[model samples]
Target chain A: MTLPAEYLATPRLPLDEDGGPVFSAPWEARIFAMTVKAHEAGVFTWGEWAEALGAELAKDGDGSGETESYYDRWLAAFETLLTAKNVAAAGQLADLRKAWDKAAKATPHGKPIVLENA
Target chain B: MSAHDHDHPHDHDHSELSEIELRVRALETLLTEKGYIDPPALDELIETYETKIGPRNGALVVAKAWTDPDYRERLMKDATAAIAELGFTGRQGEHMVAVENTDDIHNMVVCTLCSCYPWTVLGLPPVWYKSAPYRSRAVRDPRGVLAEFKVELPDDTEIRVWDSTAEIRYLVIPKRPAGTDGWSEERLADLVTRNSMIGTGLALDPSSLEDAA
Candidate 1:
């Protein structure tokens, strides 16, 4: 599905200055800028991203030269970036994965807390 | 508009929740009864979040970015620390990240997996944002969706869509509006609508505020 023009034309605030595009509010912008800075500093490269993403997509055996499957590829690329940069150690990521698993098990169906009071 | 004039059921009468709220409550109850969560604890958590870390905090952060260039720079680099600079970091925003827009590239964020947002800075994701229409369309055709919201960008701009799947969350920093020279941060914050921060609209100008009034 193509993104709507209205969504595209929305003037992005974070992009106002040459620094970078803010993802959400200023705080979110700040974190994104840091990530970009890190990427530019040779902490990671796009090739690593492509490789990681390629590997992840390969698991499904559907890497039929489709760009859409690149989403998983991007995720894998980011995982590699994090590991290479020590932004997250493999052990730490594993622990987080385990915690997420536990949380999912404890709260299956993913009901949001917003509806609890009724 | 004055906060008092805004017709929020929660502010006026707690007993009369909106239909959305009612559905949310029903879902909560179902989840609890089905052994998905601890009802009372979740209720307390939700209440604590709504009362202490809602839209007001988001407004404050946006306002600060508008007024303070140094702070804005810090915010664009380390959102968690920058927001913490204002003492607004907590919960969902503990791992907050920011994305900046440039002339060549524009950033749009979505949680295709779920409604993961920097709630500490953005409060709640609007109903439309969580809709399947938005999720499925945002990354694929952002320009068209933005147009529906009345935000039209130049064709030359490259769109970079970010999907929030991990604990890391995103927020958009909107451009400072025109014709607001020497405005205080507090006033600027008032002009920073949630939609602007979500990259769905631009900051309101004085004329738009007058029209709204």
Candidate 2:
């Protein structure tokens, strides 16, 4: 029942008054968690994350636009960092993305999506 | 409950995936397959931020600082180590600077560049904290923002706002209330509100605590 203290870490984001879900969508939560996990695993440092995210937000010009969700920047920042850090290449990520698009289409409604479906 | 219960993994309409959704899933799959990510670590990380960390950690630190002089000295000298002494250290808290609220100096923290907060101590920054207006005005008119939070500091007090960035974060040690002279650290912690640590508001008045209880 006692997780290591490191497991119990990071600043909060996305929580509203109701103490609702920390993220608006499942993918948002996924990317958020993945970023933290990657940091812990030594894939990248939080400094690197901050830099990447800041760069992504900077691309938005004022960063208060209605078009892109906040987490979109998070994901964009993450993907860019992943490639920049050589954790994964741009071509590799792109390939996987296209494959998932196909896999999701192949999956039936309410079914768990599997990469094999690609 | 909404039909969007993502925890029910099998119940999601996989066929209705948004472009971003599919992209994220693909990234997860790729990272997992590459051994750079442990699949369960994602959930564990989420559970950590969602439940493990919070402002309570900062309250404990503030309370100890109030009750112990040597610890307070250490805290003022180096906040990151002082906070880690209470066993609250991780990514966002790598560098910390504790600024105390004195009779003439009122300290506040803001991440004007982004939401770079000391999550390891005070948990996440609030939604409004990330807004453009608060971010800008926190530097321009801290006293006004404090007034909005009902923390009317003395007119002569100089408000010092610390802009947190990726390199550093800050914690404000609110002044000990007049009547809390012999209070236990635990009791003192009850007065240390999250806003107090952020410098947006003062610690809860001792009388207010009594009234609430």
Candidate 3:
């Protein structure tokens, strides 16, 4: 299967063997697929995604000295793209995130997180 | 694994929500609620990586090398090509190196900077692999790190730790366990654990396999 070249060809993208992107947590995969799907659905061009993600990676030092937090920057770039494209308002996203934190706090460990106010 | 003094007490606490975990969950919820994501598709993608694509591929490679001396020599000589011959190649494993563990030597894999792992074979790294304690201690005190994992080696066994990078990744070819003569590759593969390949544990003994079953 052909994945997005914009991400695959990017030197910064860290993929697993088989060329698919690797994620440390389920949420990483979730954000990643969302970004790919968003690009596929014409919400933004691959160039835009690449530029935003590239900037994020460079800003964070790109695993030279520390390798953690690549996907964290990815999420930040994804949000930036969403807000820039007007696909989702920054305030709305922030509000939902806060709501999730509250839900997660109330829920016990090993249980799936469900947003109460969403 | 037993609690030890070397354990980094400030490392990730399993009891509470990690900052990344909480943030990712929030993002997922927001995206799904906004119609930017399909819940089922996301689930399928995650499940594929978590289960279908993981260390089983590495286990198969280890099993083959254990059974064939020539293959073992080839694997040790040129790991990237040898692993590719077995159809395990890509991403974090572009440049691969195999370090063999013998009676006199032991090898361990760690990424001091970040969690640069051989995902093509081993899959996503376990939480402990990415913890700060492991990243730092694996380089400083490998034996202490192994002890926390309950892996005790003989005093004379020299330990060689490989620090992974984005350019190259190392996989430990753990020595084959005894009493498995004439065992099928599939059965032998089942005895290989993720920890064994990482040098934090050893291949399972045949009797333990029966007990596990």
Candidate 4:
């Protein structure tokens, strides 16, 4: 039940009491489900997805990055795989991103931001 | 901001999520708009991953095998089919091989290449399971690794480390603990830890559960 002072002082991810991964934000779980759902729909194979993820993680070299960045890589690689597989074009996703920014701003403070609001 | 902190909770609602969150949301919305993903299916996927589809599924499979001799025989003969019969079949679980722990042989699983786990049953592999150290040590110094997990075994016991691959994954059936011979599979499942199914840990001692309760 003891620990090195430096290791204990270091910032760490928030884990559930039972040590399950606690998604810091809801969107982390959303993206996770999106990846699984995409695979189920045959947008890409698990092999391709793994390769894409490996490629993205390899960008981190020693893989000492934080857990948050891991999911960033996950999302980046997912987008790459979708584009490479001709499932979703880069431009379309970018446009949607802009649309969401506007939609989020135009909507009331606490309301859900829908595409039509853009 | 501090003055109204407790009163104005919506003050920073827009800033709650990071840029990446917004990006992922955008991606999901775009995919739905373009017909690549159905909202209902996406919802179900989120729900399944969040609520169902985890170690509980594997725990159930192990409990069934422990309580029923025929089910145990089926699981040993054809893990994938028997597992699927219990409604956990998809993704990385199309092919499964179940190994049993006994008084002599102990089983452990590791993916030396990448983290290829029985996701349909165990959900996702733990962060350590995907770490380089685990991937290496699980194969090289299994006893030492198990010792680190606080799982000490007799020196004479043999440890068989199964390498999980995308083609085939493993589910370890830890030996049923003595006592409570008349336990239902559901209650027995409460003793099955995720690591037990993965073979890195053992079934919870019934007494331990009692102490926790």
Candidate 1 to truth, TM = 0.51
Separately for all candidates shown, the number of backbone clashes (residues 3 or more apart, or on different chains) is 52, 1, 0, 0
Instruction: Please report, as a value between 0 and 1, the fraction of native contacts recovered by candidate 1.
Output: 0.00
Worst 10 residues of 2 chain B by lDDT: B1-10
lDDT of 3 by residue, B11-97 (tens): 321123456655666666766676767876765555555632334688898999999888987887778888999887764345777
Q: Please give the distance, in angstroms, between residue B170's alpha carbon in candidate 4 and its true position after superposition.
A: 0.3
Candidate 2 residues A46-94, lDDT tens each? 8777778777877776557332266788888888888898877758877
lDDT (Cα, tens digit) per residue for candidate 4, span A32-106: 668766776777766677778878888887777665577778789888888888767658777777877777666
Docking class of 2: incorrect
Residue B159 displacement in candidate 4 (angstroms): 0.3
Return the top candidate by DockQ: 2
List the pairs of residues colliding in candidate 3: none
- Model 4 root mean square deviation, Cα atoms: 21.0
Better of 3 and 4 by lDDT: 3
Displacement of residue B49 (Cα, Å) in model 4 is 8.9
Report the lDDT tens digits of candidate 4 across residue range B1-213: 111111222343331223665688778886776677887787655543343223358889999999999999988888889999998776323468888899998999987432256766776556577666887889899999998999999999999888754466788999998886999999999999888888889999999889988
Q: What is the TM-score of chain B alone in each candidate?
A: 0.72, 0.74, 0.75, 0.74
Tens digits of per-residue lDDT for model 2 on B40-61?
6666555544433334689999
**Candidate 2 whole-model C-alpha lDDT, 0 to 1:** 0.72
Against the reference, the lDDT scores of all candidates come to 0.54, 0.72, 0.72, 0.71
- Which parts of model 4 have CA positions greater than 4 angstroms off? A1-118, B1-55, B113-115
Give the distance in Å from residue A48's predicted Cα in candidate 1 to where it truly belongs.
60
